[model samples]
Target: MRMLKRFFLIPIVVLVVSCGGPELPEEVALEYEALPKTLDFNQHVKPILSDKCYLCHGPDAGNIKGGLQLHSAEAAYSELSENPGNLAIVPGKLEKSEMFHRIITTDPNLIMPSPDSHLSLTNKEKAMLVKWIEDGAEYKDHWAFIKPEKHKVPKIKNEDLVANPIDNFVLAQLEPLDLKLSEKADKETLLRRASIDLTGLQPTLEQIEEFVNDESPNAFEKQVDRMLASEKYGEQRTLDWMDLARYADTHGYSVDRYRDTSPWRDWVIKSFNENMPYDQFIL
Candidate 1:
């Protein structure tokens, strides 16, 4: 799959933090990667920490090494009570920050992710870490805990092709790249697609003819409603739920024994048919 990357450009002067502490070896100093846009904590810095540093120093207290925690600013920015004046991180002070020193250290005893652990960081990751600290190392609550904010829908060049708000969002990204949505599917094809999607069955010849002949503005929606009302819709939807919930029909202790578990499967189908709320269904 191809990845689409978008950058938000903001004009601001970049400040290089003064290197005030111990000098690193020439080989240890990484080439600085310039920032054209403000670094977002959740999007940029959190991912790097989660992937490379989180396993030992993250949420798992028993596994934590060096009494160091980096999951949030409150936990990490404080001076340790045991060590009177030492601190792990000081936002916007790259040289004073011990974490950065440990990252770029050459001493086998001091370097992290611990050379013996076989975990390593790419030059890009190292450069990003440096840039983040220089930019104040601001932290935000995890996305799951934050309330969502709404923004105005983007205006696109090709508005006629848009049928809904989602289409506008898609076209906003594509218009810049000279890309467009594929040609609209014909009525017969659309009916078949909708039937298969809703009921996991292809449209019958009669259903296709009726859909193509209806010629009403809401003909497609009406056909979708009919498919959704069919018993097969519940059956089709239940297949995924069955797989996820590990619905089984046998007890095997080195011997495969068969037992009736159809009632549980029926329950899932019934829940779908009744349109049970997701939380209620899960519970």
Candidate 2:
């Protein structure tokens, strides 16, 4: 009887010991929760900036702008914690972070690097970076840090109302923000807007008359399409491409020599008329 009672009592003691084991402090549990499970350096951050920024802010380059070098994870964190002005990064805190503030800044004087570089961070990119910083700024591998996953196009309820896939993408994001597309403008308003946007000038009386006369629902689209197909569009596109390519009438050398590249310029204009894809033209 004594032996049987001892066996049953042993089981009860084990159960009680397991159930009443030591508990972790709330603060310690919170600390563990705060740590990021993983980090994505490339997708989360790198695409937000370009090589133009890397020129001065990279490891090899001189740390010119606010002594903040974003070349490596170590360097980035070091600057964040040790900056005298406290104006670069603030790890694990996005709102109180100075790095984020600089990127989203509209003030020309406060802009990063203060250079003529045309590279600008997009709003979406800024938001992603802020979220990343808030998530502890975990250091991980660069590009291809993670395997790519297939993305599916989201389904919309009103297929009849959809104009384009771009609209769908815009709507998907905007819906969460409680925003909707603005109502379509009147024909006259649209024609004026289209003319200025397409040709960089106000519509002529004849153009306006033709647009007003057309009764088709697709008239405005057709008119804009026609304008896009015009020789004027080709000419403007060529000039714009030239500006992008930084082509000048004269050679930029030590002596600032004058060189005739008119034949090349004409060739570029002709290619535009042929509706050459920019990538092919670049090649």
Candidate 3:
């Protein structure tokens, strides 16, 4: 009887051990082979400005903000470079580019798009603009530029030391700068980082304790999956949609009447939970 029980327990132990195996680190590899060393203005910058900013500053509109017109490539170059007050863009210099400065400025007086316009370019867009100016604001035709070709992954001295491919890409860039990557975070730090990233809120003491005690290899991934499946994910997504739509519960005009838009809010949340494609939402 004792032998039979031990034999049965061996399989149970193996199963538990297998389930608790340590998970491999997530892949951090860069998909792109290369990033553009220089930015072209006419190709990249013109198209972006035309779609987002031309409505206000384009030709046929007399109200050119700060006497600037970004409608035509020539107009944009002339207005930006010819600074009578020494306030225009000096190609290859960001600090000298008043156009770039105004876009990034938080002060209402210096900020672009003004109060009347609700649109604002994202940080990524602003960064691209700054890079373009830094790259001498070179204007070139679009579609003529070819996409970068895939090259062999560059060799690093301590390739064995790298836990994932992302490290390789990062180290490759850092190598040129003579910089080193930071050390791997501690277990506590890793857990906290994962928890906060997976769920917006910090983990509770009990939850933290449970995760720390869990010996399963895929424990962190399991926690991530669980959090993503929770109702809070839907709620947070709903809040994101609300921000994008600029939805408010009250009308802004004189009467300032309270509006019952909670139903619509709930509808957005439901759509997100159902994994509705963004194109369908627009339709």
Please provide TM-scores, in order, for all candidate models, with all chains considered together: 0.58, 0.49, 0.48
**Mind sharing the TM-score for model 3?**
0.48
Please give the TM-score that candidate 1 achieves against the real structure.
Answer: 0.58
Off by over 4 Å in 3: 1-161, 251-255
In terms of lDDT, the poorest run of 10 residues in model 2 is 7-16
lDDT of each: 0.74, 0.61, 0.61
lDDT, residue 116, model 3: 60
The lDDT, on a scale of 0 to 1, for candidate 1 is 0.74
| Best lDDT among the predictions, by candidate number | 1
Residues 1-283, candidate 1: write the lDDT tens digits: 0110100111111223345543433333444434335787898889989988888678787877666779989878886433546667889987667677667655566666777767877666676777778788899987656777886899998879988888998998788779989999999988888888888999999999999899898898899889889989999999888788777756624465778888878988999999987658877
lDDT of 2 by residue, 1-283 (tens): 4532221222212112223231223443354344345436665467454444676676664354446677666777663333443434567864455565555455554545344766665444555565567677765554433556666666755455568676777677666568778887887888989877666667788888989999998888898888787776666767787888888877855677778888888888778778776558877
User: Deviation in angstroms for 270 in model 1?
Assistant: 3.2
Model 1 weakest 10-residue run by lDDT: 1-10
Q: What is the clash count for each candidate, in the order shown?
A: 0, 0, 3
